[model samples]
Target chain A: MTLLVVHSRLGKHRFEVAKGLSVREALDITALRVRAACGGTGACGACVIHLVGGEVSAPTVAEYMKLGSDERAAGARLACQVRLKGDTEIRLDRPAPPSPWKSIPLENLKPLTHGLPELRAHTLGVAIDLGTTQIRVSLLDRRSGRRIATRRGPNPQGVFGADILNRLEAARANPAHAAELAKLVRTAILRAVRDILARDIGEVKAMLAEIGQVFIVGNTAMLALLGGRGADTLLDPANWQGAIDCRPHDVTPWRAKGALPCAELVMPDPVAGFVGSDLVADLLATGLTEGPAGALLLDIGTNTEIALWDGATLHVTSVAGGPAFEGSGIRHGMAAEPGAIDSVCSVENHYRWRTIGGGAPQGFCGSGLVDAIALLLADGRLKPSGRFASPPGPDGYPLDPNHPNTAITGPDIDAFQRAKAATAAAMSQLLIQAGMTWRELRRLCVCGAFGRTLHLGHAQAIGLLPAVHPGLIELHAEAALAGCEQALLSPGGVQCFDALTAKTKTINLSLLPGYEDRYIEHLRLRPIALTPTTGQRP
Target chain B: MLDRFIKAYNEAVFETDKEAAFTAVNTALAEGIPPEDIVFKIVIPAVEEMMSNITKDPDANLAQHFMTAQIAAEVTEKMLEKFEHPPEIIGRVVIGTAHGDLHSLGKRIVMGCLKALMVEATDLGVNVPAEKFVDEAIARDAQVIAMSAMMVHTATGEDGACKVRQILKERGLEQRFKLIVGGAPYRYDTELYQAVGADSWAPDGVNAARAIINLIQQVKHRDSAQDI
Candidate 1:
């Protein structure tokens, strides 16, 4: 056995592991969190650790390839690549930060003013929006359909992989890995519920007993992974256009595993393919179905889902927008957290920025990246083609002169371009398929954290969103969670979601004609060309 | 004068300036530089240089590679129209994303590079099945079949490149058409191509073009040797 001491932002921890165990494996065995975007393959170089003391195996080829010579000389090595030969001490400088939760506004929700009948009077219900990158949960007072508490955090399953595809591949490759992913998410949800109950109501055990129903909503892949079925079916391209069987064979195990007094744990059926129930929830929250014709709702994340209502029919489709929008894959990208630059603009040739909590800028979130690019374009520092007027140094274009490390690189712009192009192309195709134009798009509802903090003009300036009137655009930060809460409270919520799903004709954009050309055409950082009336109304 | 044209063209392509690249080519043509020289001496070499640079530097700008291929293809198309004698074609290739894979960017880059290198390339688009790939290659009379898979499952799945290899072997067409594979999976594991029964593999679109050209030449040479 070897003694492994890990010093992280979460504090110091010591563990005993067998010889030859990689630091990443040891950390995983101890249930310590380390970001391994490539699932500890050492390909992503995300799990970097500093060797404070003791000896380990020599640097691997992957470590040598991923990390610079200076980094290796300074004792930095990939935790997944370095095996422990003896007692070793390492420091994890960048521990996973806790994702902060924002309570859904009360005014946005329709809470029941009257109490429930005596049988269900004291029972509590929970609503969960299980997203690919983040998970939001709300504890509801079943009596009055009131939200008592809400919690949000990074989905621990992200350690396996950032995108749903990676996790799906991991799950499809190995049953044990799939089981681990399932247990990891379920445990995290239970932990969140327990923590919320402890903080808000006190007497965790009593509150846990009072919880009667847990309603969950997520994308098809997420729901399938959570229920531990339908993942293999989703891997086939043929099944992508049809409704996948995401319902679990049994629900008793979930209730038993959580040891909750809840009589039922309901996860509504996800829509076809990658269009999860979350999108359905977004529609319910925004009331898109009841809206006027030519209304569109976009819930942008790693997997961007767009729904277009053409008065008579609802058209929906999903595009793998990558993780650029949520601030992954960039040089200095991060989620919407404190110290994250959420917005940026230029004031007289100088860049002005604001962080989420008004703290020092740590990194750029999705909206800040958009605004920065738009500002650079406006100032002629960056061309509409996404090239710098003058090539930047190795550190890239610095957003803040004080923080050289916090900047956008060439690859960052490329990543954003692909993401932006895919989103814009999908939107264009949806509009065309519905026989609608930019002028006819009366309402454009943007949902999720990225859309909430996004500057509409900047998003348009960068060709991420359509050039629509300001009044047509509405931002809803927690629309999915709010919809989940609505489903938890209202008896008609499920029916509404079902009707929306039924009316929705999920178009496979890849199979659509001219989608590739449209995608490539929109790759340049310019507003998507608005062509009048390309398709006749069906 | 040719050296100056080459330098100017390479710079414009690397900078992703389409107009500047076209201007450089037109100026060379006006200066009496042969259209073939403009392509063989300028465009092909520019693409090769950019690809070699990308190979050397792990963090190469993908946008630059994409632009280089696009510019080279556009330049080649223009120069072909001005050729005194018909340009000697290298070979034909049928390319597409593997079945169950929707990623087309890598394949598009490869196609553009192939076109610039005077190789006849047919795009089969995304989610292409094994049978479709073989049928298209035969229909197009292509010497090589190229496939791209972005995910691990799609790369190694029953319906991906491996399935194409199986179809080729079953039909005894393995010797006739060479199979080349590339994308995220092959990049992660260099030997994955061998596991999936691919003749060769490349890490990116630029390298994939060079690799396919090599395979096409090999197939043509094998056929000619057999004919003799």
Candidate 2:
């Protein structure tokens, strides 16, 4: 056994683990949560740790790919990739706050259940936004249409693979993994429900007896995994039954039926294969379908769901934005947590940053990265083509040379570029497909937790978000949750969702003519080209 | 003799100067260096080096890779232009990113690399449906279909490579064209290529051309053997 000392804001702690135990394992034993977005595959570089004093195994090739020589020389390594050989004094990188992950604030949620009559006194409704990385649960009072409680947690299925493709691959390799993932989710959901009901078990039980139905909304892969049987159906495109066949199905029981004891676990119909019912929820939350014609809604997530409503038709598409926007793959990156840097400004050739809780900066979240890139582009420190104005030791652009711990490397930039390209290309392709220009759209609704807090100006300056009049952009935070709440409270909510899905013509961005040309064009990280006279953004 | 042309080509490609690259190739050809040697020795190695850099450094400039590919593609066009009679085209290829995958950078790079190899290539682009791949292949009389699926969205449904296999099998077009799957999704699992019912796979642009050529030759050999 060797003693490993870990230094963090939480205070230093010492642990004794058998020789050859990875730093990640040691941290886990200490009950510290480190971001291993790729589930410690070393592909995400998120598990970085600074080795103060220690004898450890040499860095692996995955480490070499993620860390620069300067970083390596400074004793930096991926905690997931490095094993302990002797007593080691190390510092854990930014760790997310302990579980029951923070939920959207009550004020941020807009419940559309207003004006509905009081329901049966004991009836309870659960609205869940089953995201790939995170799950958001909202427990509502059916009678008063009040949101009783909200719960959040890391999706337990992340153990299989953190992203959609990884989970799909896991399911394909072993069909049992699919059922296991679904069971994990069901168990997690049940645990969350217990946690929420734990507050006032007796009172909530009276309310729980009134539990009517659970409304679930998520991307196709997530819902498919949750359904358990659709695992095979999700693996190929030809099997896509389209939105008409994608109606909300009862997920009552797959493992041992009637497990939840709820009326049903119903998933709303998805807009298309890639564009899921979460988007339908987005549309409901934003009321875009009921809004004036020519409105555009973009819900950014692992799979960015885009919906544009012409005067008559609803066109939807999902852009695979990857996990960068969620702060998954970058060094010193985290979700929009308390210590997460949310924005950046340049001063004295150094980064001036703001964190979520105004605490010492731990790492950059999605918005901070967008701001950092915009600032770099504005100052000519980063090229539109993604070349650093000056190389930081032949790898990535240092966020601040003085702050060696905080920097965006080459791999980080590549990931960011790919994400930005996907967003921009999808937006452009949708517009061209609709035969409408950006200016023609009445409103651009930005939905999601990240979208709500994103630095819109900075996002536009970097060409990630299209340049438009600031007045036309709207932020709908936790729209999927809001949409779910609305559906449960409203009369004929399920049918309304189905109707919206049917009207939505999902355009495969890749299949659009000139999509390739536009995608390549947007891949260059530059300011959006605005028509001077018309003030239209592409 | 080929070293001089290789050096010149490297300089031009790294600088992203297409004209200079073309001039270097012309100069080498004018000096009695065979076009085949210029392509096989000079062009291939330069692309291979860029790919190698990209491998070691994930943050390596992908635009540079694309630029190098563009230069190689132009050189291939020029080489064919100089042929006294049109050189025999090795094969026709239809390439794309599987449906639901928005990634096109890798697909574009591969298309450029294939063009440089004197292959008649049509880029069907990203989010391509399986039927579209077959339709384009049939329309173009293509001998190979190359599909690039990103890791996060590599599933068969909603426009993935599995759909390509399903369509090919349904239409009895599986025996018609060689299939190759590549991208970050399948990098760790080559078995996925077989799982998706593809003939072969490559990790990057540099290896894709070689893989295609090998698959094509295998197809020819199998056909010739069956004839006996």
Clashing pairs in 1: A219-A276
Local lDDT at A146 for model 2 = 74
TM-score, one value per model:
0.80, 0.72
**Model 1 misplacement above 4 A:** A1-122, A532-538, B1-53, B67-88
Q: What value of lDDT does candidate 2 attain over all alpha carbons?
A: 0.73
Query: For every model in order, what is the number of clashing pairs?
Result: 1, 10
Tell me how far the alpha carbon of residue A34 in candidate 1 is from the true structure, in angstroms, after superposition: 26
lDDT of 1: 0.81
lDDT of 2 by residue, B102-183 (tens): 5676777777777766677898866687889889999998888898887545634445677778888888988778889888
Q: lDDT of all predictions, in order shown?
A: 0.81, 0.73
* Most accurate candidate by DockQ: 1
**What tens digits encode model 1's per-residue C-alpha lDDT throughout A394-492?**
678997789864688878988888888889889888988987787788899998758477899988988888888888999888788888787767766
